[model samples]
Structures are given as structure tokens and as C-alpha cells.
Target: MTTTGTSSSDTTATGAARPGGPGQLAGRTVSRVGFGAMQLERLRGDRRGALALLRRAVELGVDHVDTAHFYGNSFVNGLLREALRPEDGVLVVSKVGADPDPGGRIPLRPAQRPEELRASVEDNLKSLGVDQVPVVNLRRLDSGPGLRAEGDQAVDIDDQLAAMTAMRDEGMIGAIGLSSVTAEGLRRAIPAGIVCVQNAYSLVARDDETMVEMCAAEGIAWVPYFPLGGAFPGIPKVTEEPAVLAAAQSLGSTPSQVGLAWLLQHSPNTLLIPGTADPGHLEANIAVGAITLDEATVASLDAVPSRSADVRIG
Candidate 1:
């Protein structure tokens, strides 16, 4: 799994330029099998390990990497800057809105005012060592009883859009996107030229299927946050299902590979940003692109029970 000397020209069975080859991002194209840099923070381990993982991901042909100013006191972006050169074909997308607390707990906060938003974008530019980010998602206020009670105190969607539009016009961000959004939120943002949507989606959390379909129909890229359920770590439940297991057995691949393959086959608009702090795990996740499920296997996987109803909106 160590990618100390690997080049981008290494070919796979599909003969694609790279894993999950260039996908549309706000009309621009980037790799579909993107890397999520959340684990680059010193969340529960050494920061050096996280930095190495970022370098390893780039070496593995993951051209798209997602992060946020809120991740690890913004240290994760710095780590990415240290590992990746700006000229590499990397599309770094970051979100704004939440800030880390003293204890490292992240809580949803009101969107910054127009001037503050501009400053925040500038701060992200400095930390990530980039003049302009490929995509910037306006992390929305988390929906729940407390936020609901806050009511009018929350940043108005119109105001948020106004600020984002200004950023887009200024060329600070190449495209606009939304995270943790609802159908209504999307309806409001779509008119403002949203090109991407990020939400918690996996076999165990399918609540955003409607949004996924909408993005597909609109030709917007839908990047799922947790392709693997957060509740069950390390266990490949989605790929262990009877249908997937059979496919994996036939293909001689792991369950995780089958799961990711199924996801890619399910929707052309789908882009996965699976996160990992380990180089071996990152390589394994990227290699999932080699597994292709047959039509019958895909249909059987579609018939599997969905957790769409159990996902909590908060």
C-alpha cells in the first residue's frame, strides 16, 4: 500500500486515467474517488500520521480532497498544504460555518456576515496555501430543537446566498455547494447555482436518497460524506450483504470494494469522499474502483433494506 514512487500513469483493468476518473464539479471536472481529510487532525492520534496519509492519498491518484476550516482547528488544511504541491491535479474543497470549541468539539454556528465570510475564505486560502478553492460548501445550521427555537436568529438563506454569490463573482470559489441540507434547503440553493451537495449517506443512512436523485437529474455532483456507516467502524456491512458478498466472492474482492462499486454503479453523479488516517486503508478504499458489480448483483443490492427512514435529521 505504500505509494512512495507510484506515478499517475499506472493503469487498472478499466484503463481509466485514474480511479473514479474525472467527474464534474461545478462544471469543472475532478476525480470521482476523492479523499476526505477529516482524519488529518490530531483527533485521536499523531498529527504526523495524518500528514502522511494526505501525501499517500495524492500518490494513489486521488485528485479530489475535501476538508474544512473547522477540521482540527484548521490544522488539517495546513497538513494538506505541507503534503501536496499546489500544481498537482488536486481539487481541494473546503466548507465553512462551524468552528472548533476549546475542547475540540465542533458545533453548528450562524453563517458569518458578508465581510466575515470574505475574511474566512481568505483565512482558508492562507491555511491551505491555495489562491482559490475549487469548491466551498456553506455548511448549514444543523436542524434540531435548539436551532429550531433559535428561529429568526439563524442566518437567512437569502443573505447566505448573497455572500456566496459575491464570493463566486470575486473568483474566490470556483463553485458553490451545500452540506447537511434538506430538500427545502436544496430547492432554495439550486437557483443560486449550486453544483455539489454533501450529506451523510451510506448503507445505514439513506435519508438523502431524494437529494441524491435530484442531484443526478440536475447533473450536479453528489458527494456522500460517510460511504461507510459511522455507527459501525471497520466492518464492511454494506458489502457483506448476501448479494454483495456473492458478487465479491465472484469478483475475488473484499466487501468494502463491492460496496463502493455498487455505489458507483448506482448513480453516475455519485462521488465518494471516504476518509482514512492510514495509508493502507486509503489505498484499499481507492482500489475499490476496480470491482464492478453485474446488473443482477446491482438489482439484488438495490432490493436490500434501506435505512432511509431511521436517519435522524439533527
Candidate 2:
């Protein structure tokens, strides 16, 4: 791992015009309801279908897209390259740290050594066909088998931040973001000028409530990975809850839509990146920004067992 420790300001394309909907992301105004490309890997060999879905997202005025070169072993980024143009006004946010091995399973490890981090950023650039990534997140593994048992040596947050900061200074990346981070991690990352934090959070998976409020206060974009019951395993499923179902029926909205609506109203800095390879689901996910929930409904939804003790991440 090379540790040159040269940090600089971001040099990505500036002045991205905001699309109609919720406000700014990382100081650049954008649609609050963003699209996540992780689920596209499940499409298998349907690359054409994946491309079409991405294009449809753009057509629907989605200006923010969350992706990673490691997703689908670089397949998702390749699809994004073919589907959308750089001038389309889409702010592509990618991550480095988690990589899918040849077996197609991303074994969690502390691979954020400076040189590896730089190489991962370059890999994202090459796969997405961009000179500088619009936003690159340094994903930290907060919980895993070996990682949980071993502790800090598994992943040094400062070293990883230094590497990303170096890349930003070198004009290889735009803004910097972090994923799967705790409040302490955020505190350590603040000096690095972190623009966002992507963590496993939702109605049921509400372990990161403090982190959410911290991001809101610090003006950092809180990108929740699984707004629904998807992504992280072991967290209590929100969609299957009785209150969620009753509220969905009362509001005449799908459970998924209700969950997303709650998130949109949860915090101003909260950015939704619900993933779906299905075109129909994609439309529904974007439309979630419009569903307004009353205070009574919000209170009732909160009553569901969302405490951290009830949630678990694998």
C-alpha cells in the first residue's frame, strides 16, 4: 500500500443543473430520489435490458446514480457507460473497497491500502469510461466475520481517507464519500471533507439514526443503501410489518412506496438510492418522492420495532 498522503480539492465537472424534486447532493443540486445500479447484476446475461432500464431512469429525470465498478465484477459500470452520456447531467457516484472475486462473492476485507485504493479508483474510471469519477466513496466494512473479531488493524480509516484525498488532489476523482460507517467513523472522516455517507438504513433497519441526524447537521448526504428490506441481511423486514401494510392500504400506496416516502420526509440531507433492475419497479421508486405522509402516519410508522437491538448486519 503506497501512502503518499497528498490531499486536494475535487476536480469533477461542476455546476450540474438541479432536476425538479428534492434538493442538493454534496453541494451540487440534484434529484433527491437517486437510482442504484447494484441490483442489475441479477439480470444475468440481459445486458441490453439493463441498459434500457438505465436509459429509462434518465428519461424520468433521475440526475443522481449510485454505482460501483466492483458491482457485477465491473458489468454494471460497463452498462452505465453504454446507456448514458456524460453530458446527460447525471452525477455518477461509484465506490471502491468491496470487490467481487472470481467466485462472484465479495469477501469483506480491509483492502483500502493507498495503492490498492488508487487502483480501485482507476478501475472505476476505466469501467465507467470517465476521466474522473463524479463521486467516489471509500467503503468501510463496519461488520464482518473476521473483521468484527480482529478490529482496527483490519481497516484503518485514516489511511483510506488519505488515499482518497490524494486521488482528489491529483484530479483523479471528484468528491469523496464513505459507506457502512459509524458516528466515530464520520468524526474521523470529517476532516477529509466527506461529502456523503452510504449506510444500511431504513424504517426497520434504523441502526444508523444517529448517523442520519449527524449527516443532516453536518450537511453530508446520507445515502441509505436498502431503504426497503433489501441489501443487508438479518435486519427486520419493513414491508412485512403490520403497521406498514395498514398504512400502505390507508394511503393507497404500495408498502415499498410508503417506506420510500417516509425516507424522503425523514431528513433533507437523506438521498434515496433504491435499487431495481425491473423497469416498472424503477418507475415506482422514483415516484416515491411525491407521496407525502401525515404526522399521524409518520408516528404510527415509527412505532414499529426499529431500535438498533432489533437490527443486525452481516
Candidate 3:
């Protein structure tokens, strides 16, 4: 399970002063460890608690935030608008191409039509109270229920990239990103240019490892959405697995901390945007940036078996 080319300098922690140690994201220098606004609206109906959490994260030197208009049905972005000032120095990365209904139901269908993309970006600007979003990822539609592997299916992202490229040309977006994509999809979209890729990846889920390598080689930031393995409830839990538990016990760290450290060591280009609603949980997650795993531990964790059929390492 030992990564081949990882070095000590590449494993810098993201503390309040360091903040990922001069890492660059989307051509913008930002913290390698960032915040995700997905669960902010789910904090037991505590809006102020959520706002306080955002401000606290920034105070801890988190300069990058992953969010979307559909997150909490645009509620999270509105909260961000209140928490962040235009000169807060935080890069708010939002997404388009998926429109949650007013009630915020499941199965967010794709809305990548050119007109729909324009409207979606406009909605994000209005909700976040920003003139221009730093980055906008075009999320691809899933072919089925759970995460589909790159080998399972392929999606054409040419049109989607073209639309986003137009927006970038118009100065509406700072950079372009892709989500839920396969290697083939990235290949199709790369000609138009991309700055980042946000995919579902974790210690247990190595499906997108090749994509991670590709991003590394191309100097594109690899932003993994579910680095902690919480996106799919039905999938096997990484923290509960025997290998992770043993490593946590041996290292005197929590399972969540061990999991995140694995991601930071997995690749230098790997940037984490782990999400949480509780302030305590947020602090705990930030501290994960400081945990360093030994090679033996990495091998042990890598040997952990995948219990879900969704394991797509191809």
C-alpha cells in the first residue's frame, strides 16, 4: 500500500498558519485542506452554528471551500454569503449542472444544457452574493443509482466543457472543474482545459486512483469529495473496518484522522474538502492534516478488503 513517490515535504500539515504550506489550487494559491459546505444546512437547524463553523474554519487558515447551489437547496450558499466577505481571501468553489428541486429531493438529474448552465451559475452568484465564483465544477450524471466506474460507462463532456469554457471566457468563472467523471470523460474535456477534478475517492475506494495520477502529472488539483467514505450509506464503512481501527489504536488517533492522513499522503496533488456541521467535528477534521502514517500502516490499510460492489478500481 506504499505510495511510490510521496516525500516528506509533500506531506505538510494544514494548520492555522501553514494552511497546506503554499499549495496551489486552480491557478490560485490556497490551502490544501479545505472546507465543504454540504452538511452546513444539516446542523440540527442551527443556522448560526453553521455560520460560526464557516468563520472558524477560515480563522484556522482554510482558504478553499467546496460548495454548490444545490447544496441544502441553495441554503448553504446563502449561509456562505453571510459568513464570507468579498475580500475574505477564501476561494468559494461552486458547481453547476445539477438542480435540486425546491424540496431538495434525491436523484439530482443533470441540467447541463447551455441555457440551464447559465441560469445555474446566475443562481449561484445570486445566492452566494458574489460577482464571480472562483471555480465551477460541471457534475456529470450518474448512469445508475450508486457510483458508476470509469469502465462501467462513459459520458461525453465536450458540450459541458464548451459551455463552461464560454463562461470562463466571459469572466463568469475563474476556472473549470469536473465531477463524477471517468478517465475517458476527462480526456474528452481536457482539450477545452480543466483546473481540477472532484470525484468520489477514499481509503477504501481506489476506483479513481488513475485519475489522481493523471491530475498529478498534469498539475491539476485532485479534489476528492468523499475522502472519509460517508457519501454512500449502504457502502462499507472505512472507520469500522478492522485495518483502520487497528491503525488508529496503534497511532493513538481516531479512524477519521487516519483516513484523512492516508489521502494527504496518497498524492501531493490530492486536496481534501472534508465536510462537517459541528464545530467540534470541524476542529477534529482540521487536525487530521497533521497526522502522518508510516509505510507499514499504509500497507495495512491498503490491504483492507472492499465489502461493497461499488469498489471500482479499474
| Strongest candidate by TM-score | 2
lDDT of 2 by residue, 1-314 (tens): 01111212221122322222655665576778878998998886888899889878877767779998878778888888888875566788998875556553343444556777888898988998878887888877673111231433355788888889889998889889998777898998998899999887788768878888898888999888767764444556778888889889998989999888888888888888888989999888877877889999999998887734233332
lDDT of 1: 0.70
lDDT tens digits by residue: candidate 1, 1-314: 11012223433212335677657776555567878888766443676777667766766777778898767766887787877764455677888755555452224444445555666777788888776777888776543111221444366667877998889898787778987777888988898999898876776457778888999998889887667554334323575577767777888887777777777777899888888777777888888766677778877778877654223322
What RMSD, rounded to one decimal, does every model reach? 5.3, 5.7, 6.3
Clash pairs detected, candidate 1: none
Off-target runs (Cα >4 Å) in candidate 3 are 1-15, 103-107, 142-155, 306-314
lDDT of 3: 0.75
The residue-level lDDT of candidate 3 at 265 comes to 84
Better of 1 and 3 by lDDT: 3
Stretches of model 2 off by over 4 angstroms after superposition: 1-20, 104-110, 143-153, 230-233, 307-314
Q: Output the number of the lDDT-best candidate.
A: 2
By TM-score, is 1 or 3 better?
3
